[model samples]
Target: MKKYLGEGLLIVFSVLFALFINSLAQKYQTSQKVKVAKESLLKEMEQNQVIMTQWKEKHSKILKHIDEIIKNDSLQEELIKDHFLDIGALTGQENLISSLVTSTAWETAQATQILSELDFDTTQELTYVYELQNSIINSTLPDLVDIYFQRETHRKESLLPTLIQFKLHFNEIVGQETLLVTLYPGAIEKLQD
Candidate 1:
């Protein structure tokens, strides 16, 4: 009876020890996954920050030009005349709204369920950023702005309402981008921690 008891105890201990090791391994694997996903997200955010900075710079100039058009009749006339005479000066600014901010890593993490492994706060922050990115990418505001820009350029007519609409949409996107800029550092810090 003593021999049987000892054997039973040994078997139970061995099973428990195996389970503990397996649990530890699983935890380590999860930690590594979280680290990789976080690093990918941080890198993605860094790229976005750079893109956003460029966009802001370019758009600042475009917005200044738009302001000049709205405020100075002579400038509007000049731009319209220039636009018609085979001058491609404003081409870059005209296509300003067409740039898409991508979030490929975020999408990949979402698809792979890596986001679930992250802490709640980090996940929420990323969700917000990605949502803003999606909003920008999926927006029809750029199309509307392009059409309005074409009309203004071709007709040389005063389309204050159309320009106002474009400005409003553009400002909305800028505001979202600003919020993303604010959120990224905190998210990156949390991920590193």
Candidate 2:
């Protein structure tokens, strides 16, 4: 009976040890995955930051030109007299082009449930940043396109109204871009940590 008892104890201990080892291996694997996800996210954020900064600068410049055109009657007259020929020139480009900000890494992380591994603060900040980015893409870009097309179609009969609309939309977009640009750094820092 004593020998049987010793054999039973040995079997239980072996099973427990195996479970402990398996748990440690699972944890190590999870940590490694989190580390790789963080690195990918950090790189993505850095690239987005650069793109946002560039777009912000471009938008700010365009906004300044729009402000000047709006405030100065002479400039408006010149623009109209020229048949709005310099609209592109005023905007510092032949066409107003928007740069797209990417969120693939963040989306992939979320899809894979990696975001749950992140701390609350990091996840919250990234969510805010990406939400704002999606807002710009979904809301602001379409409005800008509408304004641009409206300006193109009605420049002869409704120049001032289109210009005013453009001003309002551009102002809103620039403000959004500025806020988003400010957010990128903090999110990147959290991921690096």
Evaluated with lDDT, which candidate comes out highest? 2
TM-score of each: 0.80, 0.88
Each candidate: RMSD: 3.3, 2.4
74-136, model 2: which lDDT tens digit per residue?
877776786653557558763455666788999889998989999999999999999999998
C-alpha lDDT of residue 17 in model 1:
99
Cα lDDT listed for each candidate: 0.68, 0.83
What tens-digit string does per-residue lDDT give for candidate 1 at 117-165? 8889988877877787677666644554465546453554544544455
lDDT measured at residue 7 in model 1 versus the true structure, 0 to 100: 98
Roughly what TM-score does model 1 have, to 2 decimal places? 0.80
Model 1 has an lDDT value of 0.68
